[model samples]
Target: SQKIEQNSEALNIQEGKTATLTCNYTNYSPAYLQWYRQDPGRGPVFLLLIRENEKEKRKERLKVTFDTTLKQSLFHITASQPADSATYLCALATFIQAGTALIFGKGTTLSVSS
Candidate 1:
């Protein structure tokens, strides 16, 4: 069955360390993969997107890796700070007849403290 899942436990880390998260999928081939960060009360904000043909994508302190064969993605955040703490979500972007949209995972929360 087509499915997407992320670690349910909240990730706690000390400020200045790197935070790593994982996203795994099965029974589906996505054309694109995207990562977003959501604040407590606000909606998710886009972080990065990777195409199926691309092995990885990066922007500043963020990095995303996609493996088509494994149907998985890994998201990373470097120089983690308290301000960077948030619920991170991974989505599979596919072109459905409905339109181009994102199917997001439940999300994984990261807490960074001194």
Candidate 2:
């Protein structure tokens, strides 16, 4: 079976700073990984996805890196603002006989302060 883990503690950062989050997995190979942001009451919103063949991907102020060797993915938010505060989730997809299986981490909550 595969397992995913993220920071158990909440991440605190200041506005205008860069925030880095980590996602680690074990015992499985994923074809791609995705990041999502979930507010208190809203569903998760897709942020980024990086394929196994890709080393890094970026969009606007967000960046994601996939390292198959390390079985890890790093998520970064540059020029973070208080509005960016939310629970960030890490998910991985693997193709199976039935379909694609998506596994999600517990997520790391981020709080940006002025």
Candidate 3:
């Protein structure tokens, strides 16, 4: 069976520091991996997408690295601030009877203190 896991608890940190989050998985080979940010009572916005062959991907203050061998992904937010506080989700595309849909983990809530 396929499984994904992210930090279930909220991460509290001071502003201007880098916040690191982890995602792990098992029994699945995803064609690509995606990260999204979700605000309260809103849908998640796509952040970065890393392909199976890509080692790393970046956007602004965010950086993501994928290790297919270990089946893990790391997400980082640099110079974080209170505005950066949100729940980050990791998702992978899965093949199903009806084509494919993204399989998302519970996500990790990051609380950046000002």
Sorted on lDDT, highest at the top, how do the candidates line up?
2, 3, 1
The 0-to-1 C-alpha lDDT of every candidate, in the order given, reads 0.88, 0.92, 0.92
What TM-score does candidate 3 reach?
A: 0.94
Clash-forming residue pairs, model 3? none
Specify the highest-TM-score model's number. 3
What are the TM-scores, per candidate, against the unseen true structure? 0.90, 0.93, 0.94
Alpha-carbon error at 96 in model 1, in Å? 6.4
lDDT by residue (2-112, candidate 1, tens digit) is 578996659999999999999999767788888999999998898898999999888999999998888889999999999998999999865567876668898999999
Clashes of each: 0, 0, 0
> Can you write out model 3's per-residue Cα lDDT over 84-110, one digit (the tens) per residue?
999999999877888888899999999
Model 1 CA lDDT for position 20: 93
lDDT of 2 by residue, 72-106 (tens): 99999999999999999999875567987887999
TM-score, predicted candidate 2 vs. hidden true structure: 0.93
> Model 2: runs farther than 4 Å from truth?
94-97
**Deviation from truth (RMSD, Å), model 1:** 1.8
